[model samples]
Target: MAKKFEKIGENLEVKNIVIHQLLKDAGNRLVNPKAADNLLTIGEKEKTFLGNLDKSYHKKSSPIYGIFAEENPKFRDCLIDYINGDCQFYDFSINVMNHYKIVLENTVAATGGYMIICEYRNIITSNDLLLILMINNKEGFVIDEKSLTLDNIKNLDLSKVDVACLINLTEWVNIENNLPSERKTYLSFVKGMKEVSYYFMSFIDVDNKNTSTESTKRLITAIEAYADIEQWDRNTKINKKNKVFTYCHDCIDNKKEILLSTISSILNPDNPEHFQDFATEEAYRVSEIISGDKVRMKFLKTITYSDKEFKIEFDTKLILDNTIVLDGSGNKLTIKNISPILRDKIKELSNKNA
Candidate 1:
């Protein structure tokens, strides 16, 4: 959100003047007819020129540049829009700016001050470039890459660089301070969780069958806790509960295999295949229930409460309507009902127990 630069000094300053000359020389190499016609692509040429520029001028630091070619159609279009003045500079800079910012942040943090020069080159159709300079002093500049021709380079003034287009990175200095404290904390936490999850998923994929049952149990517990907290947060009457429901429903549907396998051993102590069959059947039954179809069911034991015997009924409409409920404490409750035919089984069990 911060601008790229924070300050502007007098035009024709020594560093600016020297850098302008260096840029001109680099531009000349970039536009060389022979070099352009070489087997190496434009991107490679641009990269090579930038590499040389770093070696010749900024021996202590190297500039970074990214080339978006015809293969990268989206970025190529964005670059065209930027050159035609249809898009803002930031729009064209999105792909590379974050990486540059990260590099600058680390460099500045380590050495207390740093300067990074980078470029974005678009050669999908024709060669186009944008120059970016970032400094720790809260000042930076953007230059028209096309303006750096052999003839005009001699008269170019860097100090008078578009001060308005300058990037302000003061917010990036302490990246933690750039956003609302709570939001920043939440984002950092979520990012860390995603990184951990990525590694864990990779590990699980490698040894899914032999993965520790305890680890699977812990993962299930964590997932349940997250779901519980998220549901509670969205339980407010004004909250968009449907969005949360749809998100969770989609997640379950997408990850059904992983979820089923995770608890397969526990669900079927003796026969995992049986558990898998039951899971598949139940999934189909759930779909039918959701579609308002009266699905056939088997008898299960009835539940007795307070000395009163009650046979559970799997009335499709009732099951679907009362599938999810918010309790007094705002906890989400899922109700599973037994089929009407379970009454006879319950009576038989009670008589046998008596």
Candidate 2:
């Protein structure tokens, strides 16, 4: 499992910010990034866009644990140059915008949006972070600062964030200092629309570090830990656990990766991100997207308790149906209703003995 860090956009002190427009002409397959002369002043609109950016990032991101790919290190190179003062923030933003355009060009049927690039430091941890948000041009309008008129620019609807990435510069720098087991990936990103977001991941240049099994294991552990802290009764715990298991099984059957945010919502709909926050704070480090492991996750459907004298196994569904009951205080278990097959089997054995 990977070590978790503070979410990217929390407690931000915006040091620099820039926005570039990416638009598509009718009938053109690719979009282009418009030229920008200066950084935007950190104002109310920007603050409003940024206020919940971190929360959205937390809810939407998938972790990438490895460093930049050696063969194509354009993003890493640009980032290093900017960090080393070889390039200004404006120039870096332009470079990223250009790269995104290149990626979009190669991607068939790829579209474009407003790209907001920001460099900020966490007020609490003082960690330097970079955030890139891509908002579709049609959803909202960006106000023109000069004339206070709506123009070609667009302000992101934080609620509708589709594609974005948050890079932890401090984590990247100190990645080598941490032990192998302690190293968490520096990049967290989300591909908003399933079909349209692959290029966005490629634009960021990161490799996934954890395997499906590891991610599944950590997720299960996180859920169990959270339930323990909540002090849920056996039936409630089993019911919720079964719900998670069913969702995961369905995803696995469809060969899809499980979404942490979805699981969080399943655990607590009123507080959608509560389980996610617990996983992070408790250092379970569950990625927002993880592949389900069929072999390891199979146990979640049914629970087993065994001893030298006998073995007991039952489906978690039975607990919720009131067919099975657990007495935690007395360390006793009761089965209210036995299946007809089991009852007949017991009756046959009794007649044979008699």
Candidate 3:
């Protein structure tokens, strides 16, 4: 990420040096030798000029340095919208702008007296604001006192131009912290500004300088966390490309007769005579479609009697269908004349159901 901004700092440094040299040369040509020597000292003139500008515009506040081309309409519009509360942050552009190229060349020409320097100001802070507009080529001639024209300003070949906002990170953090958390609009604005700042910082060439403070480190951590959550959400969406479906079927109707027979035996343990009555009532409650013939046959098959007197077994089917059974003396008698096994097969079904 830092590679993206690798050339920006270098470009700015080279331009600053060239502008300073031009100022020195201009002093040499416009003043006496001794006076030029004092005024053109290595860093004296640049320092003096900056000091005077700071005093005039930011008397009691830290200075903010913003570097940009004067003619880039997108950049200008973004700045205006942000200042006017119409946008959250100054939207930086990646496409190379022709105006930025013009400014780059004119900064050098302005120092050489071939172009005039122009300054524009707006209140970025209560006590601090510095805005400079660099004009070059024929446009600069309109305001040049010396009438120096440099067509060479148009010949400077530059492939890319970068813009940056220099701010006191500590002061920015303090202001952000003091804002009420309930002010969502303001908070969102601050977050957008931080995102822009972090992107610029990725390539701003800090040059091994220990510029990180506790506050800046915390802010960076927050931005990284937000990035991670966004990545996770994106991955989750990609992973949900496949879908599945399930269905269930109930087959309780198939086992309805068996369930009814077992429940009847369980309810009438002491009186086997009432087993058929219990089954009929339960079957009607469970399913209205159970036929009378099917119910009677199922009841008969479920009940049987063992005669201890004659050691003979008489099935309920034979008794109910024929209405007769053999007694202990081998005499034919009514089905009700026979004795039933006190503990019958129904008890076994009852225990199994339990």
Best candidate according to lDDT: 2
Ordered from best to worst lDDT, the candidate numbers read: 2, 1, 3
Q: Find the 10 residues in a row with the least total lDDT in model 3.
A: 241-250
- Tens digit per residue, CA lDDT, model 1, 1-354: 533422221111111110121111111222111011111122432343333332222221111111122332443354447557786544445433333233324332221112122333222212222323321222322222233211222222322221101111222122324652211111000111011122212211212211122222333233234334435442331132233233334433332112343233333346645433443352221110010000111011112234366443232323334653447787654564645676679888999999
Give all TM-scores, in the order shown. 0.17, 0.55, 0.17
Error of 3 at 295 (Å): 80
**Candidate-wise lDDT, in order:** 0.27, 0.68, 0.26
lDDT of 2 by residue, 154-211 (tens): 2333445556777878878887467332224576655454222556667877664454
Candidate 3 local distance difference test against the native: 0.26
Error of 1 at 306 (Å): 30
Model 3 residue 77 lDDT score:
50
Residue runs of model 1 more than 4 Å from their true location after superposition: 1-174, 179-243, 247-354
Better of 1 and 3 by TM-score: 3
Q: Please provide the root mean square deviation of candidate 1 (C-alpha atoms, Å).
A: 22.5
